[model samples]
Target: MDVDARLRELGLELPEPMTPAGNYLPAKAAGDLLYLSGMGPIRPDGTLVAGKVGDGGLDLDTAREAARLTGLQMLAAMRAELGDLDRVRSVVKLFGMVNCRPGFTRTPAVIDGCSDLLVAVLGDRGRGARSAVGMAELPFDIAVEIEAVVQVAP
Candidate 1:
């Protein structure tokens, strides 16, 4: 499928890829696999979506939206690294972390926002093994953070 066209059809515009905050590269290629470093919900205007989620914190829906925004950031990074989204063959796995209160147990539901978006854009190729867990804190108190492993065409 034409991934760029797919994005256009969805009325989604990818934000500019983020620069690495530390010494690590934003994404690294190992053979046909692309390992993406952890990414947060950075909006198109370059503002971060930061908060704790669940249990009197940011609501579930808002946290989910943050996860979706983080997904967009990942896509932006992928395009920067691969030059085209079409080069992605499949999503392999995702490690999603939600910043939440101690009792929060809906992390998977919140992370579904990103998962759902990927499936919408890439069809079956977007389905992947995933783990979603809650964290007491994350860098800059971002609502959600995620890292991905993707298979890419050489």
Candidate 2:
């Protein structure tokens, strides 16, 4: 599929890939797989979607949107590393972490925000093995953070 065209059809634009804050690279490649560093819900303007989710905090819908935004950040990193989205053959896995109040058990539902967007943009190739878990805190206190692995065309 034409990934760029698909993004246009969905009216989505990838933000600039976030720069690494420390010494780690944003993405690294090994063989045919690309590994993306953890990405957060950073907007195009460089602000982050920061907050906790669940009771007395951000609601599920807001957290879900943050997850989607985090997905876009990952895509931005992938494009920066691969030079094109089409280089992606398939999404391999995703490790998603949601910053939530204690007792929140909807981590998977929140992460479905990113998973759903990926399937929409890349069809079946976007579906991947995934794990979603809650965290008491994350870097920048962002609402969501995700890391991905994808198979790519060399």
Candidate 3:
């Protein structure tokens, strides 16, 4: 299916590309690969969903949602970088980091939120290798952060 149709079917709207908080570019392309910087769970309104997962303030489901949102944000960045979502050939890899309370071991499940959304939007092209790990803390104390590598059409 076309990307737009998929997005609409999923009831998802891509937000405006987020501005980089640091000096690095949000995304960069090299040959067929587009690399995105790590992005946190900031909403469309520019507010962060900040907290540690498995903590009282953020639960697994919420962190999972945050991962999904982070995926969308990365897609927004990709669109901004490539000028069109159709330029994407496939998702290549994803690295996810969760800021969580001590002893939280369900990082992979939380990161699935992102993986599932990508597949929903891009079908088989979204399937890719991934790594999900917990961190003692993340920038802004956001519940989850993720980065991606995508292979784009020439």
Q: Which candidate is the best by lDDT?
A: 1
68, model 1: CA deviation in Å? 0.4
Tens digits of lDDT, candidate 3, 1-154: 5788778888899988778888999999999999999997777787888898885768989889899889899888988998888888999999999998898999999999999999989999999999999999898788888999999998
- The lDDT for every candidate, in the order shown, is 0.94, 0.93, 0.90
Backbone clashes under 3 angstroms, per model: 0, 0, 0
* Candidate that would win on TM-score: 1
Select the stronger candidate by lDDT from 2 and 3.
Answer: 2
Candidate 3 versus truth, CA RMSD in Å, comes to: 1.1
Writing each residue's lDDT as its tens digit, candidate 1 over 79-138 gives: 999998999999999999999999899999999999999998988999999999999899
For model 1, the stretches where C-alpha displacement exceeds 4 angstroms are none
lDDT string for model 2 (19-57, tens) is: 897899999999999999998997667789999999999
Q: List ranges where model 2 is wrong by over 4 Å.
A: none
Instruction: Give candidate 3's whole-model lDDT.
Output: 0.90
TM-scores for all predictions: 0.98, 0.97, 0.96
